[model samples]
Target: MRQIWHVGKTVLGMLLRHPITGTSIIPLLPDGRIVLVRRRDNGLWALPGGMVDWGEDIPTTVLRELKEETGLELVQLGRLVGVYSAAERDPRVHSICVVVEAQVQGKMQVVDTLEIIEVKDFLPSELPLEELSHDHGQQLKDYLNGMTTLA
Candidate 1:
C-alpha cells in the first residue's frame, strides 16, 4: 500500500538525516590521575564522555559531559590525544571519536545522578578498569604512557 511505503520512506529518511553524535572529556586530576566513573549499566570504569547534542561543538560537549559526570570543571583542554572504535569495543553503531588532553580546574566530586554508581581517581596502573571494553582500556593505557613520556 502507498501508506506503508510512505511510512517506510519516512523512517529511512530520518535514519539518513540524523546520525548519532557523541563527545568525551578526558579530565585529569592535578596529580596526573584521571577522572573515571563506574557505570551502573555494566559496572565498567571508563572516561568521562558521552553523546553530543544537536548544534553542540565537540569540545563543548566534552566539557559539559565532564562536569555532569564528575562535577569537575575543565580549565583547559589540549591537543587531540587519540580516537577509538572497534566492533567489540562498542556494542552499537560505529563511532568517530576525538580525545584531547584536559586539565581540571577544581576538585572532582562524583555525581550519582549521571548514572555513575561510583567515582574514584587512580593511577593508570591502579585503574579499576576490569569491565572496560578491550579497545577503551588499551586507549587509556596509551594515554597513560603518553603522559609519562611527557614527564
Candidate 2:
C-alpha cells in the first residue's frame, strides 16, 4: 500500500505543470494551545490552510483557509512563520505553504466536515508530530522555537 501510494504521488507530481501555492495558519489560543484539524482524506492532523486561488494574495488565502477549515475568521493575522517548498511536503502535488502563526478569535466549530474530520487545541509539546500531514509538524516546531514574531 505504501509503495503504491508513493508511486501515485510521484506520477501526480510529474504531471503537474507548476508547484501549487497554499497558506497555513497556526492559531494560538490564550492558554497556549494551537488549533489543528485532522484531514478527512489522509487522517493526518494539520494546520488550517488550503490552496491560494488565482489572483488572491497570501493574506487573503490564509484567512480564507482558516475560516473554511477551522471556522475562525482572522481577528489578527499574526505573522508569516515561513514559506515551505520542500518537495516531500505534499504528496499530491508540488506545493508551497505560506505558514502563518496568529492569534484568532472565534468559537471553535467544525465547518467543513468533508475536508476536516476533527478540530481541537493542543500544546506544541503534546502535538502528535508523527501523525501530522505535510511539513506541518516542522512548521509548528519552527513557531515554537520563535522563528517568527507575532505582530
Candidate 3:
C-alpha cells in the first residue's frame, strides 16, 4: 500500500535522476595508429567504447570495452582525455563519457557484430574526423592536440 507506492517512486526517481556512465577508449597502437569502430546503427566511425557495466570500475570498463569493440588488449591505460557530460552526447540516452587514451595491442577484429560493423586502424593524419559518430570527433581532436578536456 503506502510503503509499496513509496518504494516504486524511489526506484523511478533513482532511475531518472542519474546519468549513465561510460568509457570511450582511444586505442593507440605501438605504431602510433588509433583504432576506430564503424557503428552499425549509423554507419559512422567512432571511438571504441561502451557504457560501464554494473560492478565494474572505470579502468575495467575501458579494458573490457576496448576488447569488445576493437579486439585489442590494453597494454597501458594512458591519461584521461576528457570527461564529456553534455546531455546530448549520446543520442540513445543521457550518458557521461570518460574518454581515455589507452596503449593497446592485439589483432584488430570486429568482436561485437551487433553494435559494430567494422574495426580499423587509422593514422592520426588519416582519421575521418567529420564523419565520426556522436561527439567522437571532438574527443579525438582533443586527444590529438595533446589537450585534456572536461566538457
Candidate 4:
C-alpha cells in the first residue's frame, strides 16, 4: 500500500511539473474563412483545440479537437503556424500549444456545449482580433503573416 501511494504521488508530481501538450487548429474553410469557437468559460472567441490525449499524435489531436469543438472535418492539415509555450499563455494551466492551420469543411455547430457556446467562421479581415481568448490572437497573427514560428 505504501509503495502504491508513493507511485501515485510521483505520477501526480510529474504531471504537475510538466507543461501539458495541446494543439490549436486554425480551421480554414473552402471559401477562405477561418473558424472560431465561442468559449463558454469566458464568453470569448478562441481557436478550436484541446490537449493531446495519451497515445495520440499531434495530427490526431488536431482532428479530434477540431471536430469536438467546431464539428468540422479536416480536409488537409496545413502548415505549422507556431508552437506557443509561454508560461502565462493560458490562464488555467501551463500548456504548450502546437498551432496548426487546417483546411476544413463542415457545418458549424457546438459539439461540446460545456466548453463552447457557438462556432462561427470569419473572413481574415473580420476576425474578432482583439477579443480572442488566450494566446490565440498572436497565433492568428502569425498565421496571417505567412510565417511559421516556434515561439
TM-score of each: 0.75, 0.85, 0.89, 0.90
TM-score of 3: 0.89
Poorest lDDT segment (10 consecutive residues) of candidate 1: 85-94
Model 4 is weakest, by summed lDDT over 10 consecutive residues, at: 5-14
For all predictions, the C-alpha RMSD in Å is 6.6, 3.5, 6.0, 5.6
- Where in model 2 is the C-alpha error above 4 Å? 1-16, 148-151
Cα lDDT for residue 115, candidate 3: 97
- Clash count of each predicted structure: 2, 0, 0, 0
Per-residue lDDT tens digits of candidate 1, residues 1-151?
A: 7678668756865686643455545677778877777777667777777777778898888778887888888888866667654424444444555666788867667665647776678776687555563245655666766742210
Whichever of 1 and 3 has more TM-score, that candidate is 3
Model 1 regions lying over 4 Å from their true place: 1-19, 112-114, 147-151
Candidate 3 residue-wise lDDT, 74-134, digit = tens: 9999999999999888866678999999999999999889999999999999999989999
Give stretches of model 3 more than 4 Å off: 1-14
Cα lDDT of model 4 by residue, 3-53, tens digit:
786687568657789888999999999999999999998999999999999
Report the CA-based lDDT of candidate 3 relative to the real structure. Answer: 0.92
Ranking by TM-score: 4, 3, 2, 1
Candidate scoring better on TM-score of 2 and 3: 3
Quantify all predictions' global Cα lDDT against the true fold. Answer: 0.67, 0.83, 0.92, 0.92
* CA error at residue 142 for candidate 3, angstroms: 0.6
- State the displacement of the C-alpha of residue 133, model 3, in Å, after optimal TM-score superposition: 0.5
